[model samples]
Target: MSSRYQQGLGQDASSLSGPVRQRSKQACLPCRRRKRKCDGNLPCNICKGYGYDCEFDNGAQSANLKRPVPSDGSPQPGGKVTRLTYPQEHPKQPTESPFFPGILEPSKARYVGRYSSIAFPLYVGLEVQATKIPRLHSFAYHTGIRKEPPCAVTCEAAQKIPWNTARSLIEVYTATVHPVFGFLDMDQLYVRCEKHWHGQPQDLVFEAMMSGVIAMASLFSGTLDQDTEMWFILHAKEILEDCVISRFPSLEQIAAWTLRTIYMRCTARPHVTWLSSCTVMHLVEAAGLHHASEFVMQTTGNAAPSPEMFNIVNRVARVATSLHILIAFEYGRSIITLNGQILENLHPTTGAKDLTFQLCSLVAAVPTNLSGDALPMMQELFSSLDMITSVTVDHDFLLLLRADLALGIYRRLRVMDSKFQQGHNDRVIAAGTAALPAARRLASQNRPWWNVIGTVFQFACALLVMDTPTSCERLVETMDTLEMIVDHLNTHLAKEALSTARQLVRASLDKKRRGVESLEHIVRDASPDSTVSDTNDHLPQDTAAMSPSLTSQLPLDLDSLWAMEFQLPL
Candidate 1:
């Protein structure tokens, strides 16, 4: 029976060892658990079921589990070991990875198409079915359809964008024309400005446009890059030039509006920026209405006449003139010519006389040490005084202009006396003479009390030019006349008269000091060819120190008369 049992075990073992039958019975255990073929052996059925390596024991009982086996099927020196591998199964769609569930969904992995014929993978480790996605083709088509190549939208999730971005964009559009759309966006900005009108836009539109102006100015001033600056300048120049030509009638209003907005921007709380002021100056200067005539023409539709327009024009001109005169004075240049032109153009009907006087004061405030071209300009300015005498309106304003003009002439004469002892040019002297009749006539009228102050100051300046000491006696007589005028003004127009009288008195004192110094200088540097004898000369002792009665017969002091003082009535 034992023999029979041993024989049975041996037969079973022999059957397992047979190649074809063993292959059939010892199929992979992993394959069997997966309901597929499996090879059965010592570790066959159970190892395969657990997805572990199946090993066959030859002679070795203990094996090194740490060292991985080679796959070549060669017996290793220490032990015979073999590596087994199965073919990897791949999902049809690359996005179908179990690691990233739902990644393959059409909504999540929609493709953004490319225009080029070359196909690139949308993602790094995944293969996309490009044939199935229509969005990819649509993206390519749209991108290719753009006339100008589209720039990729950069992520701007950082700082606030500058306000000038819109202006810069418009500038870019204007400079570079796209194939599909040529400055379509820029045209909108242009049209908006062109259509804006008084009362129509109201505050809302004004605010919007003002914002745009600030932005454009910032862009043009090169707060941006060079390309942006170039673009803005080119487009801005074109727009402004066009506005100048086509919108000539509205130019003044527009300019005024722009200027007003800039002014507000400059003074706004917190302030805009440093470069904004420069931009404002640039815009104002570029408008080309700095001159009075241009200002009048621009503000008023008719260049012939318009009192209201003239008044506005006068104000604007005065402001601009004052600004320029301030600049010239600060830089040590002559402002006399500018003052002269402003005075000559003062309109009787438009109340510009005060403006004229203000500008004259501004000119006078400049240092008188200027020479050469500045001196000549002052001389020319003195010559234009003849026009003030003929003005027939606004006597108070005229008086102010005359007083200021007289003061200016006196200051110039003082400078000339100190520098050029040879005396002023014949033409300027003649012009002064021609202006005297008008001054005398205006002075004759009952005018503002300040007129007397101007008159007395004028007489004082003229007295210095007298060739004889007797003229000083005559000046004392004139002082009596001035005192009477002052008394009359103090009684009737005291309030308005004091300030002007005080100014005149100060000027007279200055003139006295200047005259004494000038006389001393003349005596010290007396040239043989000079007409008047040196102050040391007693003027021919036999001639007698003439009394006021004797000197009163002499001609009036025309060179020092304040003509405009009488031109503007009280």
Candidate 2:
């Protein structure tokens, strides 16, 4: 064997006198089981390359001389890190280990800016028309370090904000935001709050959870401005820093992170919310909340979570999954992989709750490319969503669900395929038309939902694609709704997106209206009653010039609109 190959295989090539050097017995358990070469690192080269958790056998544990020390330079409690449980020396590095086939290097990780429409593109781009499919970029390892910034207010100070005031904020959050997210067990949160106020021992996670709740409540209640609300948010984050670094995050920690994500959304930080949502999903998996059945089965020790705990877990998991999925769909990338069985376990029996879960599941299944063969499945999903509209009134996010489906259809519709072009066009129009009214109603309510701008803008884009007189009028109406939403927004990316959409729609409307007028003038001059002769033109020269060309451009096609490359951030 060549020297390099022998060295890589952990075999000695220089010493022919000694027995052929065998692979290190100190290889991680995963490497050993898979019969792969290992460099015997804490996380062996092979295990790291395959993105597997590296564990060592008891006999091999002592052979690892390089110990991962805590920040304080003290040995870990056990005097040895085992199975990769010790906190990583460089926490800022990718959370997931590198996979050999699809390496996700830290340098490749990019911040999808607040203004970038790359995530929720007006169309799915050229992927639908290409013969070869593009490789999917996984954000699994693109994790940001979970460090907390210095907070202006401490947890104790936040707790002392007058019980009456605190109670009011919590109640407002429960009534407004809680119905939508439904992650928190209100009773449990109340109990924790009461205990903390009554001189009971403090729990950092619960405190963090309450702080997040207060911050969101403050935003929705209009009791505090963005700056004031941020104090509570910072307080929650400071507490969560400890929770995030813990070996195992608790349900409370997950709830706190979920709330933080929700707050970020309300403040119109889509990119930040995406990153935060990802962090929450990771915490969900860390808590083993994703695999419901398996989590309960795998519980150790005499203490198992109560039935209430199970319900809370399911609720949090459902919301976290839905939120992550929603953002992932927009970005065209995701880290979590949930299935129907897990969703079924998380779904509530009926009402708006059940409907929300159903919508999430349907959206998760939407294919990136809309081919003729995929129509049946898309139709079924669309049908399911339509049925949902009939049974339930739109709530905190129902409008968004509808808009997203319409946008998905618009993005992936294959206009060139004559075989399915008509079918494709029909689907986009119907979905857009259906979502328009819902978007109007949601915006008319004057509630500043985090997703309202994106949802309303999406419906408008879909209508613009139809390029019909009626669609234009509806698009105008949608723009009016967007105007109201933007007025309420606090100068965020969402506001800018809606403004951009409105401008494009207005320009398109003007061009279409001009085309109709030009056509009308030409028809008027050509009427039978007209005294003008065919050879001599009584009409103005410019009017005559417009007649021939105006007919071709009468119905504004998406060709020019597409050429502009107008993209709005979600």
Candidate 3:
């Protein structure tokens, strides 16, 4: 056998030179080490399933050429090269996973919608085959601030408010909303308001800014009814509409738009808030606020912007970035793309803002295509958030951060094509559980932010989809929080989705109980005393008949839940 094999291997290279054969694509290093077949995709199917970083040996083909010849007098190189060689692994440098090639294609234009994370449940609905989801327009609650006609108007038009009323509103704003964002310098704003109220000349920008502040203050303070609040908001938008927002936007313009976006957020107008947030980004970049130092240096006057101005600029930039990122990352869309590093470099930062920006940067790092390779990054971000000990950061913010991160991770995990769906359920449930307290706190407030209501509902839906014991427990807590938010806010769309999610959870729990009972019955019937031949007869003959309890309790089947339609108004 050895002689015959040797004779067969000794055949001349010319004898094998029929048509030049093409070589197959190279396997990734891990696959080659284990001697497993590889399809050679960016993340090969096997590596992707196992959650291993798929790496290729770029030098392998070249190294094959320099291999030493065999001693058997054949032209072929030495025995096949098997081991993969790599340099010392660096901890700081993560393996660069290939981005989804489709996004990188140069010829195509990318399209991103103006939707926030609050709308993420709709995608979950799609996954569960839920159908006839109402269009976003149907449930939209616009603040009915009529747009003024094209006729030109002076800043004086916005100054028709009673001085006492405006003063009280501004004070309310300075005390409540201003601390969270610090979008305006209260001292500067107060001085300006004093001047404007006394019939002194005021810029359109100042008028617009004052109007926006009053609008939000009225809404936040709850001193006025909804209609009264919308009246103030209308004046603000009218003044803002008059400002000539050129390439170089003024501080007041930035403040005006920022306040508008915040008001829209408080009102729970997701689409409007998204659009306003994008406008803020455009104005921010146009004014060069992202690089505060350079912006100060470029000031045309002998004296640059004051420290107070700089502080406001920095805070507004950070707050605007946060607002836009929260929505963009959740909905997986973007109109303006800001670099994480630019945000990471903001000056005079607070702990909460810094941590929040870091979170934003991490979120921005998530691949647009939702590749499984980003799991390591996602895990690291979540763990880092868990380790946060800064007292300056609001507890509610931290809770929402964890919940949002978990939801993001869950979405990323679902697309991984892994066989074990339960593998990451614990991690997601833990996150959802951690966020429940924050939801309750938000609900207990006079009025929760729109995001609070949306987040609680979405998390409940996510946990309902999970349908595990721990998840269901958390789901109940989440639903309770959602109910609180819905009752307090009285948002019809949330109320509708909340009802559907509750039914789904009930059905899921019932299905689990029935499953447990059926298993117990099988175990009892198959006792040692029972005849083996009779086991089949004793078992339920019709599989369809077994779920009668579930059918009677669950008015709609799983498919019916997906096909359920809603006519809820916006």
TM-score per candidate = 0.25, 0.57, 0.57
Whole-model lDDT, model 1: 0.35
| Worst 10-residue lDDT window, candidate 3 | 100-109
Q: Which window of 10 residues has the lowest lDDT sum in candidate 1?
A: 294-303
lDDT of 3 by residue, 1-570 (tens): 111212322333232322222333576687677665555555554454334577878765444334332111111011211111011112122233332111000011111121323233432442344444322221344666875345354665334666787788889877666655655668767777887888785766667677788878877677767776777678667766653323226556777887888788767566777888888887666554443121111101112223333345456676677667666566656646543334544443555344534444444433333335556656644443333312223546456655675676566445654333454566567666666777677666653455566667678878776666777667667877777777766767867867877787788779889999999998878867665565245545465754454434343356764665544559
Candidate 2 residue spans exceeding 4 A from truth:
1-154, 157-160, 243-245, 292-304, 338-340, 347-396, 414-446, 487-498, 513-570
* Candidate 2 lDDT over residue span 107-186, tens digit each: 11111211224322211321133333222233343475765444333447344476777778889888877766776768
Reference-based lDDT, each prediction:
0.35, 0.55, 0.54
Tens digit per residue, CA lDDT, model 1, 210-274: 33343344432334564543443333333433432322212232333333323332233222322
Clashing pairs in model 2, backbone N/Cα/C closer than 3 A:
none
Q: Which stretches of model 3 miss by more than 4 angstroms? A: 1-151, 156-160, 242-248, 291-306, 347-392, 395-398, 417-431, 513-570
| Residue 520, candidate 2: alpha-carbon lDDT | 91
Q: Candidate 2 — what's its lDDT?
A: 0.55
Q: Give the Cα error of residue 396 in candidate 2, in Å.
A: 5.2
